[model samples]
Target: MPLLRPRDGSAGDAQIPATSAAEVAEHTCAAEAVFHSGVWSGLDPRERAAALLRLADLMERDADHLAALECADAGKPLRECVENDVPGAIESVRWFAEAVDKLTGQSFPAGPGVLALTEREPYGVVAAILPWNYPLAMAAWKIAPALAVGNSLVLKPADTTPRSVLHVEKLALEAGIPTGVLRVLPGTGAEAGEALARDPRIGALSFTGSTRTGRRILTAAAETNLKRVSLEMGGKSPQIIFADALVYGEDLISQTIESAFLTAGQNCTAGSRILVHTDIAEEFTRRFVAAASALVLGDPEDLDTDIGPVIGGGAATRMLAAVEEARAAGARVLLGGTEVPVVEGGHYVAPTVLDRVPAEARILREELFGPIVTIQTFTDEAEAIALANDTPYGLAASVWSAQIDRAIRVSRAVRAGVVSVNSYSEGDLTSPFGGWGESGFGGVEKSLRAFEQWTREKAIWVSLHG
Candidate 1:
């Protein structure tokens, strides 16, 4: 049996159960039938909203159990999964639930004796392909709004991180969500994910993972139904540092490294690159490296551990090899860049900081999705902006500056989807979360805009003369 393992590298007794093509076909067919029945959508919008709220209530009630499942399954730090992911996901469910009824439509006078009103309706079925890093939270990010707007959903979680989503899907059903209304298929992306993506009955598709996988999903959709697709993919985001923000050297160090190292740097929004002004480069680099090296890496079950392990041995080997390749190319290694053997069974990578990294270094340009960060120096504002925008990704970035005008200008000029000034943020529930370029084709996940992705618009026309 192919078992799902914890960060300690110990596989749980649970096997990687195979889900069949027939099963996927059956699930899609059922989801379509649910949409047509309109049992969910026909409910006064408030009832749909209430269903979501009930799900949120169940989430809170089961918070401790869910948090433990996420920690053991995905190798995430237990504290963060509980403090952030679980609660944050519950809040998202509630937020979209509240906003569902308030999303009004448009009406206009067309021509003589004609009137037109526009309505936004659910797309029937949506496929959400979630990544392993933030399993439970990412699932909530997609399904909360998708369900609130009355669309039936099919969730395909990463093979390595299926337990949490599967656990929650049961909670959702117990909260009165109809069985066909939400289906969780636990299997590999190669089989189940592709099946879901190519299924013509799936009204829309949403994915959060690597750029390579995102491209494959896009191709699959085009070759099949060409269903509406929304992707939140990979990022090699940069954090730009200015001289003025260094007035409190500790503040800059604290915020930037925290963003980079969270989830042991397995986040798509990880600020993997730090572009600093030539003037402040020395001080900023010093403080940043110091904080990174001090991070506690141990068994995630221990709350005192700052970070757990990467997903498994393969991730640790790949992340470390990238660092060695950079070192061989003459980049200066400041800290970390190796694995921590002290943490038993789970894969533990030492948080690494490198400077003078050649532009050609694979670690500098690609998303390592581990606790690795690279530093570079820029001579002026123009150079900083140019270097920051040089990558194919435009997912997220952070800018630190005391000058409000400079901060505002840089924030506007950067090509990223989300930019934070002076602080590091995963972004807010009220705003749209998405990216551009190879980071994604452009789709927002949260807030009012996300409702648009799961639902389609229709025009109602009437002839007053009749």
Candidate 2:
């Protein structure tokens, strides 16, 4: 067991077990056995839904504790963990649980004495490799749907932030989900994650992480069982601010700030690139810089804190280095781009805004995954659309324009999985969330569409004339 500390450098008592590849193999084998036993995978859909609902209740009951663990393990602001992540996770579970009975098969008329039908059945065993940024919430994204569809799941929480999800596994069992049905393996990506990816017993795998790692997982799958893989990877998402949108002023600025820096901008769909119409560029930049500078960066445990440290010292160093590199490449640093020593040993980078960042800058093309945003001016809608779609990644984008025609036009043109018009959002659970280009592959997460990733459709045919 290794002592895991919070990103805020606060003392943490959680002991994270470093699971080995052999352990991962054992767990996958156990999950497969349980999947075959019918204790879970063959149980009534309503029964599985009932157990999941109970699990949701237990999570809500222990919301405070869960939020605390999230704050500690992931260095998320206490307010964010309590108000957003924990609640969002609970809602995800509830939504999926309630949807269990509603997810139906199809019937088709084969004419005469022939019958034809299709049914969605769960893959015997599935694996979900979660990211550290939103441990609890992302876990629910995969876990709830997989369980609802009656699959035994092997969950591999990110090495840095395993506490919250490990706790979730306990609650799942207490809520009547069988022991082997929901197994949590907390370990590094190379060992346990790779083991899960390459194991033939894992019929399906869903991962949310960097693009590079997603490629590795795909390769592993290809070499082994050729298992079904669904990936939601990186993003250099753009937020285009057209002149007409400035009428919303304060509201626009506030929403854009959240889009850019939420979760310290480690979000996969973070709107890191801002493309403003040159007509209103100066005004928008001024307001954006002011609000970004005012964010309260401090210990994640404090309720008043608006920003917390990045995952660790290494993350802080990388973010700051990227900022300096951008400046050296001729970008103007409009606001805080320096490290904030909020506490001894805590990793904090001030909310940073860069103006007139060169198009060729690495910071513009790469996913920095920090509270740093870059701004560029586009003279027209076509240019804005071009700039928005320029990046190799396209998980999410935001189009701000009061003009309906312009908004609709740009939204359609921008290459992204999810686009927000006049505001910033990844949409609610009802909308399917994934990416385009390098940002995603295989399948999307959330809504009814998510169920498709965990299941296989079987078409049955029979003749009544016999």
For model 2, residues 1-466, the per-residue Cα lDDT tens digits are 5433334455455556688889899888889899999998888999999999999999999999999989887888999999999999999999999988888889898898988999999999999999999999999999999999999999998888888888899999899999899999888888889999999999999999999999999999999999999999999999999888899979999999999999989898889999998899889999999899899998889999999888888888888898899899999999889887895767888899998787888999899899999999999988998899888998999999899999999999999999999888998989999988899878878899899999999999988976
TM-score of each: 0.97, 0.98
Q: How accurate is candidate 1 locally (lDDT)?
A: 0.87
Q: lDDT by residue for model 1 over 1-466, one digit each (tens)?
A: 3343333454456555756667788999999999889888667888988888999999999999999889888888889988999999899889989988878789996878988999998888888999999999899988888988888999988888888888889988988888788899887778888999899999899999999999999999999999999989989999999888887567788889888999999999999999998898887888788888788988777888788889889888999999999999999989988887856678788999999899887887888999999999998899999989989999999999999999999999999899998888867888778898988964688879888888889999988865
Best by TM-score: 2
Off by over 4 Å in 2: 1-8, 11-13
Candidate models: Cα lDDT each: 0.87, 0.90
Q: State, as a TM-score between 0 and 1, how close model 1 is to the true structure.
A: 0.97
